[model samples]
Target: MPKLVRDRTLPALCPFCRAEILRPGEVEGGEWYDFAAGSCTCGAIFAHDPTARNGGAVFLQALLMVSGGDMDRAMELAEGVDYDVGYVQKYNVELHRLEPNSFGTLYFVRLRALGGD
Candidate 1:
């Protein structure tokens, strides 16, 4: 079975509310906070904010997963996700744009989720 590892060091801030959201382990699954309900003691408000221009970490993570730890694959995945074939090819041609050399490692980890390991 594939194990979903949770970062134990995750901050108390909720991604949606920015409040100290309750941990899944702390309460039953049914009581988990709703994305719409941004209420929390920390006075954080819920904002359905879109990602930044650089595509952010989530995009990078997805890019790595589709790439299968291969630079070519990663570029292809990024292109496919971006819905631009030429952009992908161009990105691959210029590999210096992507940051954090660990993208390949992260991609491998994502592959494990799909039973690639």
Candidate 2:
């Protein structure tokens, strides 16, 4: 089984109240905030993953998952959100890790569009 490398507790703000919403008054990253989970004072479930190493990648995965593996839908969502992931030069983005005997994972993607135009 894959072990949990680490866990942290940050802050989660409330959308309606415009204040930090905590499971309790005082908390940290994973304790108060979870990348995979989020709740606001308004009781809204937010999918903001502050712990994510790459926000863009996380957003892409989220879009794909929510679209039920529909690439077109995911692309549409990405375009609608204005998170332009530059044209795919070449590379296969796999959501899974390679086998032990497989080569290393190296996916080349151009994120320059993130800057603009």
Candidate 3:
């Protein structure tokens, strides 16, 4: 059986809103850490982990960005109760494709119900 191959010229979609995501830019507020980050129309935040091994860091960055630098709040929020998480695995940003042999990952986070909301 032949391995499936996906077209590499298409745009990537946001996991939460399904909107076509624009290529990420250097994230603000954390110049110390390098991340290609962006937000969706539905309020979901995303960060690309090129090496796929920095998912935890990537997730933290996304969470922090979404929460407006609230590290304490970001860490306290529960996965399903306060927010939701999703991943685009084997993602290749340059080609914007889900390459089967790649090791990149795009982490997504969306707040479900924050305090007083």
Q: Judged by lDDT against the true structure, how good is candidate 1?
A: 0.27
- Using Cα atoms with residue i matched to residue i, what is each candidate's TM-score against the true structure? 0.21, 0.28, 0.82
Best by TM-score: 3
lDDT of 3 by residue, 5-86 (tens): 8555445788877788877778766663478988887888889999978988898888888788788888898898888998
CA lDDT for candidate 2: 0.34
Model 1 misplacement above 4 A: 1-55, 78-117
Q: How should the candidates be ordered by lDDT, best one leading?
A: 3, 2, 1
Query: What Cα-based lDDT does every candidate model obtain?
Result: 0.27, 0.34, 0.81
**Tens digit of lDDT per residue, candidate 1, span 1-117?**
999985333233433224444322111122222211122342222211121233334344333423433557655443323322111111111231222221211111122223222
State the TM-score for model 2.
Answer: 0.28
- TM-score of candidate 3 against the unseen true structure: 0.82
